[model samples]
Target: SNRFSYSMNLKGASMTIDTACSSSLVCTHVSKLHLRYKDNEIMPASVVNGLNLMLFPGPFVGCCAAGMLSHEGRCFTFNSTADGYARGELCGALLFKAKQFNPADGGLCCLAGSQTNQDGRSASLTAPNGPAQEKCIAAVLKEVGLTPTEVDCIECHGTGTSLGDP
Candidate 1:
C-alpha cells in the first residue's frame, strides 16, 4: 500500500511500531538511536507518524466490556473522578535529524535522548505495572543526564483507566 511504501522511497531504513499508546514515543527513541549510531550522511533524517482512527465499533465495544472507556465520556486525567478514557482519532507526525544537521532550522527543538523498557511478567498482559513504569522513567532520565528534580514538564499517555492512571 502507498501508506507503507511512501517511507521506503526515502532510501533509509524504515520500520513500524504497533505498541498501543507508546508507539510514537517508542519510534522516536529508535530514530534517535539510528541517528546516533548510523552514518548521518546516509540517513540524515527520520519521520515518525502516528495515526489513529477510532470510527470502528469493534474495538470500542471491547474497551467498553473491559471497563476501559469513560462512562461519562471524558478523560479525567489525574483527577478524583478519573474513570476510563474517551477514545478519539488522532494524527500526528514528527521529523528528526542528527545533531550535526541542525534540525532546529526546521523545528523548534530536537530530541536530546530517549530510552525504552518493557513490563516483564506483569499480573496480566493488559494490566499496567507500576514498577516497570518507574524503571522506564528512571532509565530515560539517566540516559538524558537529568534528575527528577531537574525536569519541570512531562507528557504522559493519560489512558484514563482506573488501574492505568497513577
Candidate 2:
C-alpha cells in the first residue's frame, strides 16, 4: 500500500516474490521479461528490490536447531572449514530499463538473461539438488545463446552448509 500510494502517478504492474535465497534473482528475471514484452509504451522502468531483516530469537533459534548457524559465527564460503552460514541483514534495490531506451548509454552492466527453478522431490525441502541446479544453469545458458565457458562470473546461494555447497 505504501509503495502504491507513493507511486500513484506511475502506471505499471508491481509484484512481490518470496523465493527464499533466489527471490531477488527471480525478480530481475521477471523484470527482464516485462521489458522484453511490454516495451516503453506500457512500462518505462522496472525496480527490483530485496530486503532481509533477521529477527532475533525466533529465526536465530530455528537456524540453530536446524544446524544452519555457524558455530564460529563466520561464513567460510568455499573454504576447507566450511560448516554453516552466519546470518546477516541486507537491503538493496536496482532499476532496469530496456537497452533500446538509451542505446548510447550502456549503463553499469548488462543482464543477458536469468532463470530459476525449485529442487523438486529432493531428499529434503532444504536440501540442494545438484542435477536440478545443473539443469537450471543449462537452461539459462541456452536461453542467452551462450556456453558455460563463455560466462565469467555467477553469484550463487552459498549458505556455507557442507551438503548445500555443491
The CA lDDT at 10 in model 1 is 68
Q: Per-residue error at 43 for model 1, in Å?
A: 0.5
- Models 1 onward score TM values of 0.87, 0.87
Highest lDDT: which candidate?
Answer: 2
Candidate 1 C-alpha lDDT tens digits along 15-69? 7788887888888888889888999999888888887887779999998898888
CA lDDT for candidate 2: 0.81
CA lDDT, every model vs. true structure: 0.80, 0.81
Alpha-carbon RMSD of each model: 2.3, 2.4
Task: lDDT for model 1, please.
Answer: 0.80
Backbone clashes (count) for model 2:
0
How close to the true structure is residue 151 of candidate 2, measured as C-alpha lDDT? 91
Runs in model 1 deviating more than 4 A are 1-8, 100-104
